[model samples]
Every structure is written in C-alpha cells, then in structure tokens.
Target: MKRLKEDNLKHFFAEETLKKYSVVFIIILAVMLICELFIFNFKWVNSAFDKKVDAEMTLSGINESGTDLKFTSDSATIEYKNLNEELKYLYFKPGSNKGGVADITLSAVDEANSSYFSAPSRTVLTDVKSSEYIRLRFSGEVKDFKITVNGMNGKTISKDNIGLNVRVPLMFSWIRFLLLSLTLMLLYVLRPKSFVYNYKTDLSKNWQRIVTLALVAIQIITFWNMIHWNTGVLEWHKSYEHHRQYYSLIDAIKEAHLYLDFEPSSALKNMDNPYDFRERYAQNVAFKWDHAYYDGKYYVYFGAAPAILLYLPYNLITGNDLPNYIAVFIFGIMIMIGILLLLWEIIKKWFRNTPFALYLLLSVVFGAAACLAYAVQKPDFYLVPSLGAIMFGLFGLAFWLSAERKNEDGTTSLISWRLAVGSACVAIIAGCRPQLLIVTVFGIILFWNSVFKERTLFSKKSLKQTVAVCLPFVIVGAAVMWYNYARFGSPFDFGANYNLTTNDMTKRGFVWGRTGLGIFTYLLQPFNMDAVFPFIHDFNAATVYQGLTLTEMLMGGVLWLYPILVIGLYGAFKKNSFSDRRSYRFVYFSVIFAVILAILDAQMAGLLTRYFTDFVWIAFIGTIITAFAYYEMLRDNEHSRRKFAGIILTFSVITLVLCFLSIFAHTEDSIMKANPTLYFTVQHLIAFWM
Candidate 1:
C-alpha cells in the first residue's frame, strides 16, 4: 500500500552541486597538507601549548612514583627521589566549564634551597575523561613539587593525578594529513559525475547514491568512535590483555627480520631473543593467543589473510603497521557495503515492487546493526574472524546475488563479473570461518540452472564460467594450505592445537551431547533486561548444560533479539503462496543452510554470541527475502492486509532504536566499561533534554 513513486536523491547532494562539494573538500585537504608541511619545518602549530586538551582525568598521587595510578585529590604536595629532576611534572583532567572555570598551576619547590620553577598556567576545558600527563619540561628535574588547582568556584573540583605519562601530540599528526589526502582522492574517484547524468556505473541510480553517501557519513562516526578514547593499551601491552597479540605479531614482522618469527618486536617486555629461539639453540615455547611455536619459529595461528593483505604489506610500504582497530573499522565499513549491495541485488530480483526505503532498512539491519554490535565493538584479535567473515562472506554473497540483473530493454544479463568474484569470495569464506561453507548451499541453489544447462560435464561457455569462478579458490586455497604446511608441518593443520585456550583444542573433540541444549540456547535463549541504561545482560551460566565444551557470554539467542527472522520459513508455513519456483527454492536452501550452520556451531564451536556470526546472517537474508514475498502477497491480494506492513515498519523502527541503545548498555563489558567518559557524556547529553 506504499506509494510506488521513488524520491530523487539529487536534492541530498551537497548544495545540489557535486563539483562545488569536491572543490571545497580539495581546498580543506590542501590546507591540511600545508599545515602538516609547516609542522615538519617547525616543531608544532604553536610555540606554546596547542590549546588542545587531550585528556580530562581526576587527580591521584603516584604510589611509587611511576606504576599504579590511584588518583586522589585536586591539590598534591609530593616528595621526589631527585630534587631537581624527577618531580617536575603534573597531570590534568580538563574542566567542564559548564559550572565553573579551573586551571592547574604547578610550582616546583626546591626543598634544599628555597627555589621554585613553574611553567605558565595553561587554561583547561572539558574533554573526554581520559588522563594525560603534562611534563614541566624544565631544564632539570625537581624532587619536591606542589600542584595548585585554581578554580573560580570555591567548590573543590576533583581533578588531580601524579605524573607517570608524558604524552606527545602525534595521535593526530602529519600522518592524518596523508590519510586525509587519500580519503579525498577516493572521494574524487567515487563522486557523482553529474547528479542528472546517467553513467555506466550504478552511481546514476537515485537511491543508491544516497545510500553510498549515508555509508560515508556512517564511516565518519564509526571511525571517530573507534579512536575517540583509545586508551593506548594496544600500543605495547605485553600481556594478552586485549589485541596485543595481533599488533605484537605485526611488530614482529616489521622488526624481527624472521619471516614470521617474533623478535625485536614492540613491547614493554624484552624483545631481543638472546635465547636465539629461531636460530641454533632454541626452545619450542610460543607466546599466548594461539601463536604456534614449532622448531624455534613462532607462527601466528589466526588467519594469514589479514596479515598478508593488510598488516605485512602495509607495514612494508609505510614502515609501520596501523592499529588493528583501524583495520577492523575499515573492514566493518566494507561489511556494510557488502550488505547494502546484497540487499539491493535482492530487491532487484524479488522486491522490485517494494519501496527503496525497504531495501535500505533490510540492508542496514542485516549489514550494519545485526549481531548486536559484535563486529564493531572492539578491534582486537577476537574480531579478526567476525570481520573477515563479514567482509568476505557478505561481499561474496552480494556479488553472487547480483549474478542476474534486468537490463533497460526488458532483457536479463546472466553473465556478470560479480559471479566469478562471488565464487572466489565463497572459497575465501571457508578460510575466514571454516563453518561458513554451509552458505555455499545458497550459492549452489542460486546457480542451479546454469549448472544444469550444460548436459555435458564441460561446455565451452560453461567451462569459461567455471574457470573464472574457480580460479581464485584454487589459488587462495592452495596458498592457505601451503601456509599451514609451512607453519605447522601439515597442510590441513591451522595450528589450533597450540592455542592457549582454556582447554587444549588438540585434545578437544565434538561434544555431540550438548547439541540439543545448545540449539535451544542459541535459538531460543531469552534476553536479560533491567532498568539500567544498558539493559541487556549476559546469558545465565545456569541455562548452559553441564559439559566440557567451551562457551562465551551471550546476550540472548537470535530469535529472542530479532523474532521476525522466523519469516525465512514462510514457504513451509504458507505453501503455494510463492509462485516463483526459483525464489522458493532459494529460500528453501537458505533455511537448510541456516539450520546446518546453527547445528555446527552449537555442537562444535559451542554456544557463544560471537559464534552467532556464523549462521545469524542466514536469518537476516532469509527474513528480507521472505518479507518481500509476503509484501507482494499483500499487495496482490486483500488491500486490508497492508496494515500488517505498516505495523512492521513502525515496530522495526522502535526495535532498531532499542537495539542500538541495548548495545550501548550491554552488561559487564560495553561502551560503559570501555570508555566511562563517553558513556557518562552520552548519559548527561541525553539527560539534559530527557
């Protein structure tokens, strides 16, 4: 019952002019580049402080002058080991000028000779509440120092911490300018040629352009959120605290000189392998987080695609590897692109009658927001599989879906470049998550006709299609298998045996007994909610069966979070409603694949939220396809049934908002714990109006 007419997205362009926008973007980028060059000449933009408040931390005294950070008071009088050298620095948590103004005044006290050295007071403003240390940078260190907080209000503002941090302004440095230039260049290439001009690229499509623009906007926000409060733990923390293993391996590749040997790596711990682990006399000891140690060489147990594709090559070209979070963030954006393309392809095939908004809705839900924010939560080694699967799986599937598209002359094009790319994507999908091979069922069903067209095993055109499609798989698969052999001495071994998991994977086997219970928990597990801001909580450990299988904390089952996914099985429930035999067959196969993946994960990988990434996408894709079919049924039949569509739209909007908020409020670990300042800032920002 929705209007058939579509909105022209031209109005959404920058001031209705693409050229104007490009020119302005170029100007800004040029300015940034010039500024970076000037910085290279001079030390900084300003001879004095840059007026940028990097951190806003509460005050605390250093217990032993450097290690444990327990901030205490706004003012501190401390004695240092060296009178003129050690105690000459102070820290700041910028003031939130809403109520009053404050500045941290430091006066170094020379206890032996009644002399003091203090830097000019720097004004402060509220910033993201992470601590930053400001060194006095005086000629010599002072052992005795006194910090005075000057506030306009007599109210004792709590903001103080003893200095153990000496921060540089390199976080947002010249490197950002180079990155900015790259971003601008890509934008230029992708910019709309002319809003009104129809071109070979699909950029001419009115709605697709809007969707791409929305993607660009979303990327800005996601990238901002990734590094907004990067606490620097990922820099060089020695332990397995977070994504240290990921970057540590990258650092090893860069400096260790050993192909994959981890030595001379960036770390707070000793990196020199004086023990000569990779040389003559060595031990077979490996670092934690699945770094396999075999014959004095350390091989990363995770997928080599990320390192080979992103880290190693990038480090070689740029002389350093980027933060793993940045890679995950970019991959997350690609996942969105893939999902968007997939949904668009689906709309082209089945839901051409539906509105463009519907396509975008399904795309955003399944592509970006599905799985309760697991993909973008934190860019650690834990995310490598989820990110890889999302990028390769969705993109591969999207490309496959675009295999057949209608032409302008009412004809169809069966031969699409996407098919070959999709074929290769499916092959890589197994490397990302070996279990995702189940999705290949959908692809097989998709090309069922093409496979059947040729009566012979090999035909001229069919052979070409097969070669184009299967070549990437053959090459990538061989390389992956060879990589395994090079590392673990077996082509099939991915070194999961040497992993530092709770239980030894080499010793672990399938827990078939847990399948029934795991299926129930994975599909029907109830979501826990509370009155707290982040209402969702972890699955009750009691609900899990008593077994030896491993599991991670889960928010809820797929069905509990998104119940509408059950519509994927609409064919079974409302038989004969689907007139399109091919579409019905696709849905049938998708359901089977979903079931297979769920069983595999529940029985094999264990019941974990992250594991849901394996099969939950099936529900997402199937739900959209089924919804469109149902939409057609309503449109062709009783118009009164249209209210159901309206209800779904209204409910979907509400649900998405709640889901977004729930991710923010997820219990135990979330934005609330990861960055308390961001969480409080959001709460306060919301509270100001609410």
Candidate 2:
C-alpha cells in the first residue's frame, strides 16, 4: 500500500511539471513559426488572384430644335440618369476659369428618329489658372443624342486614395498567421509555473485592488478636468461682430474642419504655396479669454478615444465650446496620477520596508516638476496618449517583478496583479498614440521573457491566456489604425500638414532635420542654458533659451532616485536569477525605446527633459534596484546601513537646496526686469531656503 501511494505521488508530480513547462515550449514554437513565416517567407504554394469592376454611364437627348451644344469635361464625374424634360442638369467638376466656355457641335437627323449625340466632343476650358472655381457654360438645342461616358482619368482625391495593401500574397499572410499561432502555442507550452504561483500571493492581490481604485479615480478626475476646465473655459466664443475684431467659435470650428479636409490640386493656379491654404483656413479665428483653443487648425485636441468619449456627454450638455484648459488640467492630473502609481508600485514591490512617507514626498515633487513643465510649456494634449501608454507598461513590469516563488508543490503561488494591471495599461497608452506601438511590442517581448525565459511558465493554455491578456491592446491598436485610415487615406500617414507654428522651415530645416537638432540641443544645452525662476524666457538669434542647472540634471534632486536606478540596471546585468534581472532588463529596454522615440521626434524646439519623462520612470526603477543592492550590502552591517541611509538623506537635501537656489536666481532676475512684488516674494522664499 505504501509503494502504491509513492507511485501515485510521482505521477502527480510529473503531470504538474508538464503543466509548468508547457508554456515555454509553446512560446518557442511560436517564435520559430514567426521567424520562418514572415522573416524567411517560406512558401508552401503559388497562386494568382485578380479582381476588377467596370462602370458605365450613358446620356440621351431628344429635341426638335437644332441647337448649338457644348460638352465640357470636368475632373469630377457624375453618374448618369434619364430625365424626361427638354432641359437637363448634371453636376460636373467645377470648371477651371471663372467664365470658361465650351462649344459643342449638335448633329441630328431631321426631327424624326432619335437624335444621336454620339460622344459629343468639345474643348473644355480647364481651370488651370486660379485656385477658385471657374464656371463653364454649355448651351444646346433639343435633339436626340446619346452620350457615353468612359472611365475617369484625373488626379486622385485624398478620399479616393485608400491604399489598403491587401495584395500581399495570401500564402505569405497564411504563413505569417500560422507561424504566429505556433509561436504563441509554444510560448504557452513552455511557460514557467512560478508565474501562476507568484500570482496567487496576497501581496499581488492587495496591491491590484489598491492600484485599480487609484486608476479609476485618476481616470474619472482626468475626464472631469478635460471637459470642465480645458474645453469649457478656453474655447473661442463669439461676443463681438460689427468690428470684426473678435472671431466666432463657429468660424474656428469651420477652420479646423477645412484644415483637416483640404486637398491640393496640381491644376489650380496660385495654389503653389501650401502655407497659403493653411493661412486662409485659419483666418478670422480669434482667441477666447487669454487662451486660444485652436492651433490655427484643429482645436487643441486630445486624441485619446476614452478621453474623447468622456468629453462627448459633457459637450452635448454644454454645447460645443470645449475649453482648452480642461484638457490641460486633465493632462496635468493624469501625469501626476501615473507618476504616483508608478512610484507606489515600485516602492511596494521592492522597498516595502523603506519609509513610504519619504518616497511619497519625493515622488510628488519630482513628478509635479516633470509633468507641469510639459503641460505649461508645450500645451499639446496629444502627448497624453503616449504618456498614458508608458504608465501602463510600468504597471505591467511591477506586477511581473513582484510575483512570489513556490516550492515543489501542486499548490499555486502569488504574483503582483498590480503589475498585471500595469501591463494592461499599455493598451490604453497605445490607443493614445500609435507610435508607442514600438513600446508595446517591446513590452510583449519582455512579458514573454518573464514568463518563459525566467520563470519557466509554459503550456498551451498559458500561452492562450497571455495572448488573451494582450488582445485588448491589439484590438485598440487596430481601431486606431482604422481611424487613421479613415481620416488620412493611409494608416501610417499623419496627413500632409507637417508645419510647426513657431519654428519656420528655414530656421528649423525640414521637420525631421529640426527634430534632430532639438535632440542635440537638449543634451548639450544643460551646461550653458541660463536659469530663471517662475519663467526662463530668452531667445538667441535662432534658439529659445530656458534656464536649467547642471546639478539638477546630474543628481535629479527629489529625482535622485535616477542614480539609484542604475544600480537596478547593474543587478539586471550581473544577477543570474530570473526574478532579480527580468524587471531591470524590461526597464532598460523601455529607456532605450523612449530615447529612440525622442530622437525620432526631435523636431520639437527644445530637448526638454519632460520629453524623456518615461525614461525618468525607468530611472526610478533603477533606483529601487539600487536601494535593494544597498540593503543587501548592509545585511551584515547595521551601522553601515544607517550611515548609508543618512548619506542618501543628506544628498537629497543638498540637491533640493541647489535647485531652489537656481530657481531663486532666476526669480530675482525676472523681478528686476518685470514685477517687483512677485520678485520680493521669490526673494523671501530664497532667503528662507538660505
């Protein structure tokens, strides 16, 4: 009986082992399939497919009087239909010249049988001279004639140019699908068992609940602020009319629509300058209160779908005057919330025993500076989407890192669900900005590595579950793509209007060139840029100057956690254990990705540190790792740990003092030049700091 019990136990253990490692096999297979299909283009079959549609139009005329007729060909075509009256009208492309004339020869057999207008030929005066439409007149007598219209041949309109590349060989697409499926399957089969065990931990459960509530509150607050503050207050409204000095909100909306919808034509004269089109579209639009909602084209629009949806109800309730300040406020609040959540997740996962109070204070000050700087200066809410995405990624990393390990048993272990929620947030981030798709891909890879490479969680079922977790992001991403296609004709196209208002093409070069310069200037200017309190406004012959200090850049003050973050990176590189290294690798990848993005988007005027805020979060992660390293080092020496802690505190205080001093210097200068009262208040603050 004892021998039989041992055999049963062994069988149970074997089954459990299979379940644990199945996801790893699944992922490996999936990866192999992907590599073979898309990258190698392994072909299984060859076939040809073709599809075509033909359209025809016919026009007939029956008249008794012999009439001199004219036929004009406008770029725009109209579908033909039969009319019973002698007089008929058909819409055609607007003519090129103001009063262009076309002469049509009308021939018909005596007033008896059907008068044939067989393909009436006329020299249609083209409107190649002006941007404005030219009306063409065509006069004809009643006669029987048939006009056959052929296929259209003209410049394609923006709407008609939808380039859906469905023509990629079906075999290739099938192979890709197959490979993706297989890789996903393998990933599932070979995934680590620890993931499930860690997920079962109470730490994971509690944090998940806490983070969810925080996220919900943040989302609600963001929505409220976007609708109530930005959209409600800063929106342009009509208060004056006779003097034509004040612009109407309706005009602003119209201008936005025109700017978004306008298409340039080769045949239109005096339309050579694209800026003219933009300028004409923006004319008569005025600022509301002290803030202008429109960027001469679109309203200072926040492009995230959730935010937009939230604002819709409010817009309906209040009518269309959406204040820009609402967006600004929401953006600010969201940034703060994201940063707090990130810091909280990091501390909870890695530094739970550390002083939460100190961490909170440091997080608030640092996050506020970074977020507020971006908000007040740039005022572009479109960036919120990207920011939201990075926040989600951070959440995912936190969860993956915080999962608990399980010993040899059939029971489950626990992992941080706060981290899972964070991963889920990546989808929301991607929705806000499509470019973050790169980050999303990197995130998926990191997650896969965590589950398979580190924890050895593998099974078909686990792989499917992983894909399911990722589905929301994919669906949202596809929706964004479709939206882009609908608006821009191509999913990848950002539309033709790539102009920046302040930075002219000559000074900044083309957009890409300017962005390159911006990146270069950002890293280089820290050494030389002047500092001013409240405001740092100086413009060189070409560049705008803002004051930033070197010490702040190096030590990061309340942001001192950045230096510590490097320690985490060091752990990632040196530690052989999956748990110790995976999070660091993920953060490292994120930082690199963020840097690349910044470089790609270098067209902005300055290389503001705010642009790299996501990277700063990665630095925070590094700091956590560094703190862990410090803890480990002090494990045998209590006195040293105490000394190290004191040193860190001192360093933080000194950094803060220096930052304040820098701010004070700038405030004093500004007050001397502009406002004495404000200057005195700043001076008093400086004195207090001193």
Candidate 3:
C-alpha cells in the first residue's frame, strides 16, 4: 500500500511541474543576489551584522538642553576630532517637530582638507513627526570630519540619540522580492499562446468573473489598509468637525433646507467684495472655507448627488454620517465592476477576436489606472463627486452598448429598459460633476445609425424605443435643474462663480494666454527621476506666459506617466485598421473630448493632479480600443502578437508601480504626512543598505 501511494504521488507531481518550480526558485535567487550586490550595495553576507565603533566628538555653536540640540543661531557644528578607524555611518534618532522642517540642511566636511563630504542633501527625517532612526553614509573613509548645519530655521535635533560607524545589517526586502516573483510567474503563465489567440474559445468569458473578483478584493484591501490606522469609531455627523461639505449638506437636507446650515460672518457679509481673498485675509474675517457665498447665504458649491445618494440615506437609516472613506470605497468597487462590464461588452460587440491575455491586460489598465488611484488615495468630500461621476459614466456607456439585442430572424432591436436605464445613468453625471456630463454626447454617436441614418428614433414603429431613450434624460435634467434653482435661484447658475475661494471667480474671465500653459502642464510635463527609492519626484511647472498661473508641484504629466496612451493618437488616424466603423468613430471622438475637457479643467480649476479624473478614463478607453484592434491585426503573425502582448504587459506593470509611488512624492498631500511611521518603514525596508 505504501509503494502504491508513492507511485500515485509521483504520477501527480510530474517532472515538468518540478522543473517549472525549480526555474522559478532559481530566478528569484538570481534577482535577490543582484539586488544585494548591485542595488543594496552589500559587500558580503557576513557584513550584514552591525558593529559599534567608538569615536570622540565635540559640539559647538549649539546649546544642549536635555536631549535637544537647540541652535543658538542659523548655523551649528559637530566635529569628530578622533576616531579609532575609518567611520562608515552616523545614525540619528530625530526629535519631534509638529510643524515640520523648513529649508534645513546638514553638510559633512573633512575640515582639514576644506572639502565637503557626501551625505543626504537634506535630513532623512523628512517626516518630522516621527522618532525613527536615520543614517548618513560617507563615500570613502572618514577618520576626522565636521558636520555643519545651516538654514536651521530654529529646528532642533536630538543630541543623545547619535552613533558613529553603526554597521547595520544589509538586507533586501523579502516581501517585495516574493511579490515580484509571484508577479513574474503570473505574467509568464498568462502570456500569449496559441490557445489564447484562438478567438473561438472566448477565454475572456471564462476569466472575466475571476479577474474582476480579484481586482475588487485588491481595491478593498488597499482602501482599508490606508484608513485602518486612523479609523477608530463612527459618529453622527462626525465629519462636520472636519468641514466636510457632504456631511453638512445631508444635515441641511434632513432639516428641509436647500442651503448649508453654516452661517456667514456679519463682518464678511458687510464687506464689499467678500470674494476677494486679500479682503478676507486683510480684515481677519471668519467665514466658511470653499463654500458658495451668494447674497448672504452659504451654499454647497460642489455637487449634491453624493449627499443625496449616499450621505442622506445613511444618516436617515443609521442616524450617523457616512465617512468619505467609506463612500469612496463603495464607489471605487463600483468603478471596478463598471470597467469590467464595459470591457466585456466592447469585446463581445466588436473585438470578439481579441486575445485573452490582451483582455486581462486592458482590465488592469482601465480598472486600476493612475487617475483612480489619485482620486481614492486621499478620500475626502472633494473626491466624492469625481468618483461618483466616473462610476456612473462607465455604467452608462456599458448599458448603452448592451442595449442592442439579436432577434429570432437574424435582426437586432433595442431593449427598452436597458436604453432608459443607460440614459438615466448618463443624466446623473450632470448632478455629480457637470464637466463630466460631456460624456453623454457619446450617446448621440452611438445611436446615430438609428436616430439620424434610419429615422427610426421617433417613428411610430419604434415609439417605445424613443420614449426609453428620451424620457429619462428629460426627467433627470428637470430634477437636476429644479435642484439648482432651489439652491442658487436660477437653473443655469450652478453657484461656482460665487465661491469664497482664492480668486473672484465671477470676474475671473478667460485669458487666451492661459491656454498654452494649461496644455503644456497638463499634457506635456515630464517626470523628475532620481537614484533613490521611489525615485519619481515633483517638479516646478515653469511657463513663459506672464500671468498668475496657479499650479502646485506636479509629479508629471498624464501622457508621460502612461506612455501607452500615446497609441490612441495613432489609432485616431488609423481608421482603416478597425473592424467596426462605429467603434472607430468612438475612439476618434473620445480623443477630441479628452482634449476639450483637459482645456476646460485647466482654464477653470488650474493645474492639479486631481483634475486628471476628468479626462484620463476616456483617453484610456480610446487607447485600450486601439490596443485591441492592433492585437487582432497581428493575428496572422504569431511572433508579432506575442511581442505586442509583452509590450502591453510591461508598460502596464511599470505604470502601475509609478502611479502608486507618486503618492509618496514630496507633495502637500503625501503618505508621509498622513502616516509617517508607515512611510519611513517602507523607505527603510526597500533601501536597507542606505
């Protein structure tokens, strides 16, 4: 019986399977070796252990009170006059700075040679609130050196928590290495093959559900991981203290009012031109921040759809205000589902012959793109409308594409319910994000053959279809307009012009010169790279236009961040490559609409990364469409098909990594600010040898 069992186990574990596993193990080992030697700069495995070295040092030009080194002036010095041997590292455990460091510098000098030694240009305690250990390394040998601090800005360093020649272990991140190995194995298995290219099998039909479930789980996990550190309890109208607009809007609606309950200060109301930021600051007047101030009333200038759809219902049922992070989580999952449904519909309708691997690649590209990450990372009231618009817009397009039905006699007819539902979803965008309502224009092109070419939209033969397509728009539009009128006294005025913000929007008309800067910054900005962990950094957007151009530090432009989207431009001109003419038109129109929205956002809102939400999705869709068509075109050439598929996967993986790390850049809204411990831990884990 034992011999028989062993034989059966051997049969199950074939030699080929063993060989594959061995290859994967060997690949992982090779990668770790390279990282330890070249990337982490570890000399030997035995050197991983730390060794303490003794040195005599003296401090000057600084006052030591308790553990703090308070600089008497703008500069201070620490001279290591004697050392047993050459020193390699100096470790520091920083003291707390709630207000954060400002223009601080620490320079190492071999004072005898009058030369500056290498060190971090700025301190590694970037997250000033934490007391984590940080180290400074020397390039060659350092028997004697003086460390100088300039531009101190009244900052203090911890005096007692310092060490010399602390030889810490040189370790590579095992978690990251294992993840890379798994990712490589997954890609190798999912790579294009003969079976994948066989369109008759329709492998996407089998894999779509599985891939979507995995993506949804990933989205939820990331959302929770970001918030788990801070979320302690739920409270009624909890976000009110944080000046959340949605919470306040729901509270007002519950009390049967159209405007927010926040009252404008009499001083600001009495002043002429309260919209002027300088006037508000100069007078020291207290007023609601970012609220619409019109005729002595404060109103929520942001869309009310999120409040009515999510916050109001939650408040009514549970008597507790829904937090923005929870709402964002729900919307993000819906967006992922909508992306899958839309991609499935498009593949089913037009690109039926698309390779299975290509479909999976597009799923990652569309579902987890940089724009969605930006919108979801800092969950707040500001992100609610953008997420809502994206979620519903994707569903609207998907339902619209799915409305066509094949009949018994080889003819097609529109499903009345599906058409009406799709229109209703599209109309909701006007309430959530007015700028994104431009997506509804695609409906006209989608039904052009039936409405204009065949004149069947209003014909007696298709009366139900006409009502299904038109009634929802009329009803939703009227409701949205009525809501607007109730708030701002006029249906046409959405109340943005009356906002008490940085500029007087009512008088800030368009400037022709701003267009050039807007386009360049939004579409053509390049990324700043460095030889450090999370190397992508933010850059100043310099423009020749002499105007008050409002721009924050930009990480990079959308096109440069995701270079794969450039294919959409080629797809626009290569109309003959597409199998479906209507699909070709959709791609062409998407490119134009993306450009128009970019110009609109740049002109109206100025340059910010969050504005990418307005148009990146549509551009990604166009690019994905082009990619599918290109893949199908290469069906006859197997080698070309495999090569193209590999290129798509490579671009997608690299782009996803860059986008996720972009959140950690030195920006105002960075992970380092929100959670300092997590940031430094990751920094140390990846660059342990540093």
Candidate 3 residue lDDT tens string, 393-458: 999999998997757986667888889989888888887888998888788877877776555566
Between candidates 2 and 3, which one is better according to TM-score? 3
Top TM-score: which candidate number? 3
Ranking by lDDT: 3, 1, 2
Q: Which candidate's lDDT is highest? A: 3
TM-score of model 1 (CA atoms): 0.64
What lDDT score goes with residue 636 in model 2? 54
Tens digit of per-residue lDDT, candidate 2, span 457-514: 3445355445545566567667666655655555654332333232222233335445
Q: Each candidate's TM vs. the true structure?
A: 0.64, 0.48, 0.86
Q: Which is the better candidate, 1 or 2, if ranked by lDDT?
A: 1
For model 3, the stretches where C-alpha displacement exceeds 4 angstroms are 1-22, 29-52, 60-78, 93-112, 115-118, 121-141, 147-161, 170-172, 190-208, 226-243, 408-410, 454-456, 687-689
- Which segments of candidate 2 are over 4 A away from where they belong? 1-270, 273-302, 306-310, 320-322, 347-353, 373-424, 435-442, 450-459, 500-520, 527-579, 603-614, 632-635, 654-680, 687-690
The sequence of per-residue lDDT tens digits that candidate 1 reaches over residues 18-74 is 666667677768776675555432322322343322232333342232323322444
Cα RMSDs of all predictions?
14.7, 29.4, 5.7
Cα lDDT over the full model 3: 0.71
Clashes by residue pair, model 3: none
